[model samples]
Target: MDLETLLSFEWGIMMPEFIILGVATVMTLLDLFMPKGLKRKILGWIGFAGILAAIVSLIGLLDYPVTTILFDTFRLDSFAKAFKLILLVGAALVMLLAISYEPKEGLTEYRSEFFYLFLTALLGAMIVTSSGDLITLYVGLELLSLSSYILAGLRKENRRSNEAAMKYVVNGSISTAITLFGVSYVYGLTGTTNIAAMREILLALNDSQSVYLLVISFLMIFVGLSFKIAAAPFHMWAPDVYEGAPTPVTAFLSVVSKIAGFVLLVRVMLSIFANAVTDGPNSTSILLTMEDTIAFIAGVTMVVGNVVALQQKNMKRLFAYSSIAHAGYILVAIASLSLFMFDSLWFYLIAYLFMNLGAFAIIQTLTEKSDSEDSSHFSGLYTRAPILAVAMAVMILSLAGIPGTAGFIGKLNIITGALVREQANYVLVSVMIATTVISYVFYFGIMVQMFFRKAKVKDPIKIPVGTGIVIGVCAVATVLLGIFPNIAFDFLQAQFYEFGDFLR
Candidate 1:
């Protein structure tokens, strides 16, 4: 196949990315020479507007749907579009929070650069959702990871921020290296970098060693994604990084980065494992073996993430671990990859973005007026800023999977997906139920601090309009998606079927 043909786009399929790139460039130029006062806020608005344009473009392009794009290097199914919408909305909210945060974080000089990096990172995530070739997926991941490293280091003067950046880069680089090694192995085995082509090659192998090949490749790729989602054993960098990096960046990492990794995982597995049907003597079945491996990872990831999070006292670190537990829940969908799994994953991500971002944005707003990062900072939050406190409460309750909130509905779908496949996934369903209960304790623990405790120290909190508005919007979304999950799930269900057909 010609390279030009592979890279060629339908233009309509490429509009969101074009908007992201164009706005990112304009923001970069504005940062270089613009006068120093309130003008910088324009860049934040521009970034927000850019993300809105991308979201609009994504909605508009759904009318011209195709299951795959760029000669199958990309796919434009419901799964990809659903994820694109989540990422765009989450990134836009983060941009709004950052508008009020840059001055306080002492990042005033480089605030415009934040918009530039944020847009690029958003672009990378959008690319990951759409990428169909393994090579394209890898490139998109690297672009997103590199931008995140820089974002973590943006608060350069703080020792913790610098340390977090170093740890992130080192840890992230090692994971990337492992992922590439696995990709190389897959290439050598199949003589192709195309995921669809590789699945055909893998399914043809029938010996015991084929099982070993599958295990090794999945493990290597898992290393990279584990880091992205902050899963255990690979989660060492997250607590320190979350405690140190700017709060909006933490929110971005928790929501956007995790969603991107999961999107790629679903795409790759749906193509390679879900559809691998072969009849041969001594063949180790592709779909069953992959399901078992992912199920094991899902089990271990939940236990480790929640157990470790219980020990953290820092609010950011607590949420960092909370984010990991959420990652484990997302992985359960991967463990049960099927037609319904795609819908479950997208709905869950939409719910997670609201809960995670709304929670962290509140922390960012409150932290400005406090000296400590502990949960104590939230003491008497109900008494101080009742509206914001209510927003934070809604977010935390949703995250805990309490009824009448977005997180509950997301979890409900995942549990239903697991139970529907329970005959083949009994162990996974049991583990998932156990982990969900374990997670509720940690999530509600924060809510207890926010609502039940009285203030030991009295300091009035100041919240920017942008921050307040973003939190209010996320709070409303959390409630909306929770009460009416069918609306989002139905919207996503229409596009998710394309993957089922493509895989078959």
Candidate 2:
């Protein structure tokens, strides 16, 4: 801990996180001293600027060699860089939505706090991406979870918000406890919390009892982490939370929060279980043994999420289920365990950040206008605002995986990834296609309401400047990526190729 030793640590690897922390601190202080009557929306702009700065800083470090700080607890590698870019960009978009957010109720009083909470959550997600140890990963997860819990209940007077926060706390606590118990078992077996060191120990294991313990631990960890991604059976809390939380918070959960969850899952499963060999007559890696189990979970998640969404009349609730179904699609890539896994997952996530957030921006605008969350609120949207109606159609079509949309290309990559495997995962692939078709029923339903139904009120919906920016950017990105996916795919392949060994 001497100054010279501390100086030897490559602190430059942590520039992105440092920037976020600094920004959060400054925003908190600024909020504290600002005039009582001053508009809080300015704080959102400040937060957005900070995230832009952080994104710039991160881009500068793209060529940084694998560097671990604090005794390997935090590592800056290609994996971290790629995912952090998504986190920063997604947070930036959510910040825009926050800036323009105007609920039916007067919840603007806490708008400044909303911006800062998002920064903290982004920090946590960034940390999780780079963390090289279980303890640090868990710490980051909890940081994100706690901030999200508070954000969910920010509409303090709304009973649904209160209930959402309560459910989040209860569900999040149980998941954390289960995850910790699993980590404890892992530490007991390997005698180390360091992921790299534990990988070596687990791979060399020869005892059957130890293998059994490892399997149990794997299941516990998988089940617990499922809660974060809103994977089914564990996804019961999502619809309520999405419906209750502020619209920007809902966008954060769907895009940034879900991305972090998958990052953590990929980090842990690939690093630890990819090489952990089970001792028996037929020896194999732990991940291979559990591939079918993981596929089953993926299948169920897609089915449950899409089927349930069909029944949802609330726009937020419907998108909540949509989020769950998308998680299932990403899990398909994970279950494939192909070399192209990262490429497909990252591409899908980037596309998701654009299309999903754009859709939510429209939902927020309409819901606020009608002062209702009903599907009927969107009736005759084309008659009132044809431009926005067209934009919403693009987003909804993307989500439905139609041709010439980013979501379609993302799914194509995933399916191709699965099919190219030595032993193709036909079952999971089939389930994915079926559920995606099922999802179209709900996705197109939104379009049907917008284009076909008569408006209860004939006035045009006014879009705020911030909302317009978000919708414009997201819509452009969605179509661009769909047509020219190579822009992102090429970059991902190049970057991931260099860090490919880290997963091994």
Candidate 3:
């Protein structure tokens, strides 16, 4: 393969990154120089508008037959387009929530910067979905990770904010370093960094020792990637970071960051495992070994995340654990890769985004009213803010995988896909069912506090229009998807499975 040929584009791939970065840079400039008043609001609008424009561009242009860009370092297809749309839409909603929550969090001074970082992080995640080479994937992941570290500490004066930032930076650096070392291992084993070329080399190997090189290198890379998604054992940093981060930042971390990490994992595993699996008895492929590893990881992460969450009293920390548990559900989808690689994961993520972020938006708004993050403040919330209580109830129901909500659809798809892979694997099936039951205890625990408990104080909580709009949209999306999941599911299936046909 000629290096020059590998460096290739159509207009479709460049526009998304270009428009997002332009808006982010302009917002950064405005944040640096604009006076502390109404002018800053304009910057926020501009950044939001820019993301809106990019979303339009993506929806308009993302369906043009799969194409390769920058010499195949990036690829454009329905799969990439679908994830980009989800990230952009989520970014837009988070921006509005940030506008409403920033003042309450004492982050009003840096509103423009906040939006700017959000856009940049969105751009990075979009890049992660599009990336087709190791180098491109690394660049996108780091861009997303660095922006998030600062966003985690957006409240500079808060000690927890600084501590979270410090921990994030320290651990992030170590993870990235470990990931780079694994990348080096893959490069050494394959003698190339291009995924397709490396897969070809691994497939050509004829002995177990040679193929073990393939499995070990991939596992090493998965370590760093898994940490980004907050899968258990590597998830120590997430609870404190989510609790300390500004609420919108926490929402972004939980949603956008997880999406990017999953995209990378799906791409890598599919490319490598699919090739090895198809090569037959002559090849020393480790696809089954890899799947077993992923399955075990998925089960443990689901059980541990939910069990730990059951003991948390703080809203953010509770949801932080919930996010980890959700990652396990996502892993179930990924583990079903042998049956269908992308459809179930994409469907689950779209729903997960609305359900999880909607929950966070309500938590942020409630914090504003009570001026607290403790879960106790939610006691008798139905009397104080019935609308929010109802919205939170819907989100919590969805998260708990209750029927008639988006979370239910997401969980249904995952388990159904898992069954497709191994209907008789009672262990995998039983664990998924049991862990989900464990999750509901905590999810409903919050709702019970809101609806069933009597108010300890007489004051009513006021919900801001901006915050309400954010949570309302998410609640509507959750309910809409539940009643008619085909809305997002059709698009996701078409983009991944139907579009996957184009690749073959």
Please write out the lDDT profile of model 3 over residues 146-252, one tens digit for every residue: 99998999888888889999988988887788778777866876787777677777666645565566666668777877888999878889999998888889999
CA lDDT, every model vs. true structure = 0.79, 0.91, 0.79
Off by over 4 Å in 1: 1-9, 36-38, 67-70, 102-105, 207-211, 275-284, 369-371, 422-424, 494-497, 501-504
Best by TM-score: 2
**Residue 479 error for model 2, in Å?**
0.7
Q: Across residues 1-504, which tens digit of lDDT does each residue of candidate 2 receive?
A: 899999999898888899999989999999999998999888889889999999999989987778888988998888889999999999999999999998888666888899999999999999999999988998899999999999999999889889999999999999889888888888999999999899889878958998899899999999999999999989999999999988999999999999999999999998998888988889999888998888888999999999999999999999999999999999999999997898898999999999999999999999864445999988999999998999999999999999899999999999999999999999899999999999989989999999999988987578999899999999999999999999997887666556555553
CA lDDT for candidate 3:
0.79
Please give me the total number of clashing residue pairs in predicted model 2.
0
Report RMSD for candidate 2: 1.1
Best by lDDT: 2
Off by over 4 Å in 3: 1-8, 37-39, 103-105, 277-284, 369-371, 422-424, 493-504
**Candidate 2 Cα misplacement greater than 4 A, ranges:** 369-371
**What TM-score would each prediction reach against the true structure?**
0.93, 0.98, 0.93
Report model 3's TM-score to 2 decimal places.
Answer: 0.93
Model 1 accuracy (lDDT, Cα): 0.79
> Model 2, residue 141: what's the lDDT?
98
